[model samples]
Target: MESTSCEKNNVVDALTAVEMLAALEQYRAELSEKDRVIADLRSRLEILEGVNHELQLQLGRFHDVLKPLTVQLTHNLQLSAGRHEQYALPTGGARLKRLAISAEPVDVGLQHTPAKKVPKNDV
Candidate 1:
């Protein structure tokens, strides 16, 4: 009876060990997948960082180029402003009113109307 009881305990322990091994294998597989995902994300982050650095460099270059142009533009504006009695625009709104607001009427029903074909490109 003692031996039989020991055998039963041994069988239960063996089954427990097998279940533990299976769980460990499953956990190992999950860990490996997570590691792969982490590596992929890390690579993508590196690429984004590289692009950001490149863009930053381009922005710096553009700032350097624009500095002189901005200075020149400001100087030119100052000169023009000095030439005018006042810096403000003319008060009459005459220029704005000069724009044509409506299209011209087409004489489509006229007997003299002839359909002009587009010229062919000979080249």
Candidate 2:
């Protein structure tokens, strides 16, 4: 009876050991998968960071190029505004009224005449 009880305990212990081993293997597999995912994300993040840096550099260059143009445009606008007082530029409504008074009335029905098409001679 003592031997049989010892053998039962040994069998239970062996089964528990096998279960523990299987659980450990599963955990290791999950950890490996997580590590791979983290590595991939880090790689993508590095690429995006590089792209972002390049874009920032391009934006700086664009701003540098635009700065002089903006200054020139402001100067031009100031010059034009100064000239506006000397030039008698027509106002919008006055120009429209002048154009309307000068324009001739159009005959809508006789506006367009299509040319007659000659019949093809089938020789």
Candidate 3:
């Protein structure tokens, strides 16, 4: 009788090592892809932040441009509301007045004049 023993123990270890290496490689690849995505997102965020900052600056400029108009409108509203005594212009109001489009006053229709009544005899 002849006894034959299979020595495939090393083969199993080698196969397991190869599979582990392949899994590690795949994991590395996935991590690199995630890193790239994160970097791309970061860059996009930066660009959006810059655009937001620019928009904010533009909005501020627009506000600055419209400040005089706003103040004038507020003053007009106050005048219309008969709050002329309460409404006082800021120091910059002088400059805004100089930039006024027209020196003509705007009528809010609050003035009233009494009409004299004459008695007439019945005909």
Candidate 4:
């Protein structure tokens, strides 16, 4: 009987060990799945960061291109205004001189004559 009891206890211990090992394997599998999910998320974040950096670089390039154009446009406007003033000054002076010359008075004498009018109803 004693040997039989010892054998039964051994069998129970072996079975319990197998059950514990199976539970540990399940927990390990869950942990591995979580690690894989975290890795995928990290990869996606890295891609997004790269894209954002590229966009910022492109924006800077656009600003660089626009800056020269704005400066050129301002320079052209100033040059055009200077030319307009240079050309207009002589014409304005000439116009003023002509106006002064033409404004001199010219006089003409009027001759007076008396005229008689007949009434339409009498005619």
Off by over 4 Å in 4: 65-123
Task: Write model 2 residue lDDT over 40-119, tens digit each, in one string.
Answer: 99999999999999999999999878866775675578688874333333333133123335233376664565545777
Worst 10 residues of 4 by lDDT: 88-97
- Going through the candidates in the order shown, the clash numbers are 0, 0, 0, 0
* Candidate 1 C-alpha error for residue 112, in Å: 92
Flag regions of model 3 displaced more than 4 Å: 1-6, 92-123
Best by TM-score: 3
Candidate 4 global CA lDDT score: 0.74
True-structure RMSD, every candidate: 11.2, 11.2, 14.2, 20.4
Q: State the C-alpha lDDT per candidate.
A: 0.76, 0.76, 0.76, 0.74
- TM-score to native of every candidate shown: 0.61, 0.61, 0.64, 0.47
What lDDT tens digits, residue by residue, belong to model 1 across residues 22-120? Answer: 999999999999999999999999999999999999999998788667765755787788753233332322221243555444565764566567768
Candidate 1, poorest ten consecutive residues by summed lDDT: 88-97
lDDT of 2: 0.76
- 108: Cα error in model 2, Å: 74
